[model samples]
Target: MNSQAIADRCEQADVELIRLLYVGNDGVVRGHAVEQDHVPDALESGVPLPELVQSFNALGHRVKDAQFDAVGEVRLLPDCSSFRVLDHEDRVAAVLCSLRDSESGHPWSADPRSALSRQLADLADEGLEAALALESEFHLVTDGEEPSPHGDQGVYSTASMRNGHDVILDVVDALQAQGINVHKYYPEYAAGKHEIVTKYGRGIGAVDDYVFLRETVAAVAESHGLGTTFLPYPFDGATNGCHVHLSLWDGDNRFAPSDGDRALSPMGRHFVGGILAHVPALLALTSPTVNSYARLRPQAGAAAYGCWGVENREAAVRIPTAAPGERDTATRVEYRPADNTANPYLSVLGLLAAGLDGIRNEIDPGPPLEADPANCDEATLTDRDIDRLPTTLGEALDALADDDVLRSALGEELTESYLTVKRSEWDAFTDSAATWERERLRDTF
Candidate 1:
């Protein structure tokens, strides 16, 4: 593009940031990103401004291949998620980009986006592919609570979306304005709760859409005097979650487990079996929060046990069980454990690792517990020998620690770092007297 055209685009980005300064979430402010859950912290303490520039230049050199172009305009390209450092209007500063492999199709370890990309490449190695999708769930909170309650809406329905329809519409517009495609959206079970189902996505792009969606939704919601949260079980008994749906394939063939059926054939069942076998461990990535336990209970609609079957939501892994080819065309398994809480990078990596382990070992996933495993007697579970998933984040972490196959997926450094962070979080929780414990034990003691 010519010099004048480039000048105009940079001016447009400055104009957008200025407007956002006026309407963007107050937390985002004019020069800082809202420090929310797990937002990356920069700790270059006490360094001089000149030294910081050298350090920043070194940071850019880490991933020298996926070059960014934000000097003259808002760099919103396929490989880069727009980075607008309000502090540096003329040049690039802070960013969250889609990392691509410089050498092969595999993802780079330094770039979190590549974690899922590598997994997808691994799937292709087995002559199979994964079609990945995600669900978005969060609450809408106002500055006040009771006297001025939020919107009235039912689960999987609409009313709240209509009452707060303007913000919802703006959210869609903003995302589309940036070329992201969100499918259907509606009210969730709780008041002011909502969910978004995006158009089919695959690999790093799938996760790219996810992070961008959450970041964008919050941005738009702020403009409407509403706050959006992807927190699972933001309230006790809310049971809200972000479940990932997946299906396998061998080139054009969709994979599922059906006897005598070459399609979704035995290989497919074994893959599902592998998913089931490592499921107890998979929960560490899927449901990675202390509050995650609240949603795993049978009443919460998240299948509490590790099992898979045709058309059973109660199963941790469930197949669509639709018509012939329907299972292929729309064939998929619903992994109902994840929430927005887990880092998208690690969660997808853990999932691909476990599934690949299943494929490699040729593991046989015992018979399906077509019935509600929860209702089954202890003898029934043991007779079937169905082991329940870890009941707490601590337990899940321990499970991941033991599963070497899982750890190898994220490499040692990333794995160790993740555990260190989570272990610290667990310690902090144990040290505090939570609301539940305070209410239950305070008066009694």
Candidate 2:
């Protein structure tokens, strides 16, 4: 919809506020709300935001980066296509914004959303497109000094559904009201954990949908007098992971194998190969935070090694089994090392860039590991050429610094700012006297 159309809809709906939303470098959604009277002008001219927002850490501390000082401004240019009337709130509407230079009106080099758009444009230039769906896991907890799961039911059990039935139904309703389609919803492994799968979206719209999904889920849970968290390791028994399912297409499913016996097409193999080749560096964006590392351990179902397999949970990438007759559309790769803590736009951008590089160079992903990497002995691991992913955020950042391919894809300004902000987070976590896990980490995400 255009600005005028959005204004008309708001007028009809009696929307009192319109939020101009954008995800920050810290992977948190931050935005300014405009009164209904200012909707048209804000949509047209964009909302001005401080340039230093790109340099703030997740804890809201501004990193000491020289390039991202508090001297300039960037405009939050709302994408009219992303306009949605939030059903969970009272007379409030929202639209996702892309950061643009305040004076020049060009996309800001440090804008994560714009970065994803650039990657998509490059893929379009090569006659390829990507569809992505995110499987988001989060926890619902009761309020107190130490919050516990809201329900006591087990994983995937009917009792679990019965326990959280009202809240879950409300969440689905709110999402559908905002035009987000829900594919599935189920109780996850832990007591209070839940997973929601949404229908796939092409290009950057997938990430935009994910942002809305997180916000909607959180808001609905809050209305029910419960707390929600997407943190990877909120209370330890189970981890919250937002696995990314991606497929490449050129008017057809390129990931589908032509031969009946083969698992993936040549292009699909190359894509997975590229992802494996860059797993360590990719984790800098995928598993981004210090808290995220707590979830990426062996035997934890979070994928601890850089390998691909058919339905292997221990490998970072997995080729899921397609439905009996829906192979063409169902063929895709699931990257499992990610969580809700990472910025979705940057994570998918890095994934696509790495996969495209693999296609360009015909990077072979070698043989798929049929067995779990964690169970394999050292010699077997070496023979199969499997490598462990970075065990900590600092190590992942170092890998990202050394990776020329990813750095070039993210560009200099974004790379520098991202690194500076992440490194500062690492240092803060390591040096702080507080219980980093419970005190600082639990409530942030």
Candidate 3:
């Protein structure tokens, strides 16, 4: 679809406002909406947004060292293919945009979406394709002075499903109305917690679908007079996670084992090896918040150790068992160390960069762990070469700062900007009051 087609559909749908949306470095969606009359021009010429927005942190503070300020502007070049009329909001539609230099019309160096596109282009050069899916978990709460969970029934309970059935079904309807497919939905481990799994998408479209899913969930939940949060540690107990599932293809599923006895193909092992080797640094982009560390602890079901396993939730990377007779199509790697706090574009980019590096160099991932690393003795852990993931946002950032491969993949501008913004967040978190942190982060995603 092109600008004219989008404008025509907007007119037919009576869309009064068309939002040109983009995800900021802070993993938040920021955008401006235009009136219906301006849809065509806005889509063609692009909307101007302050470049300094790329330097802002989650708490809305600008990182001074990010090398961007109020003096310049970037264009939000709307991707017409992503246009969708809102099913929940009346007279409104939205399309995701890519940031471009206003003068030269080139992709901005610091754009997260553009960064992912660069990685995809490199992968295409190798004749490889990737598919990704997200298992999103979030909490629905009552909106008030002190928000609380909407339901008390625990994980996977029929009672919990009964309580949230209406709103959850409504969310599903809204999403499907916008052409996003739902693979499954269920009540999660904690009260008011729920999980929604969507069908996988190819290449950059996968992350774009994720962005839409997040926004749609939030919007539909709000319409029910309820508040929703994607924070890693919205409260104690079970934390919300947005686990990533990835699979590679080169005419066939590359991760699939050739023989029935093997766990993964040689190429698959190398990919997992790259992920384990770079996970400490990758966490800077995956679980990228001060509060995110609170969820990455041992025995939390959020991966704590850098290792891969078959059906092991405790490992950073897990190779799920394929359904009988579906090995070729279902084989994939599940990366469990991420949450909703990450910018999906950058998170997937880092994963691809690490995996591709492993493939090129044929890096061995060592042996897979069949049991939880937390239950293993220190000596056993040492023998297996498993290391605990970074315990804090600062520690992860430090690792990212030293990772030459990841830094090169992200490019100097984006890498520097991301580090500056994240470091400022870490400093603020360390210096602030606990109450302030909780209040500010409760609904950030």
Top candidate, metric lDDT: 2
Q: Once model 1 is optimally superposed onto the true structure by TM-score, how far is the C-alpha of residue 184 displaced, in angstroms?
A: 1.8
lDDT of 2 by residue, 293-377 (tens): 9999999999999999999998999999998898999999999999999999999999998998898899999988999899999
lDDT of 3 by residue, 188-305 (tens): 8898999989998899888888888899889988888899999999986869998999999988999999899878999999999999889999999999999999999899999999
Identify the superior model by lDDT, candidate 1 or candidate 3: 3
Q: For model 3, name the residue pairs that clash.
A: none
lDDT tens digits by residue: candidate 1, 246-272: 766666545644543433466666777
Q: Which portions of model 3 miss their true places by more than 4 Å? A: 433-445
Off by over 4 Å in 1: 1-78, 81-95, 98-111, 145-149, 256-263, 322-325, 434-445
Better of 1 and 2 by TM-score: 2
TM-score of each: 0.75, 0.96, 0.96
Two-way lDDT contest, 2 vs 3, winner = 2
Name the TM-score of candidate 1: 0.75
Error of 1 at 352 (Å): 1.0
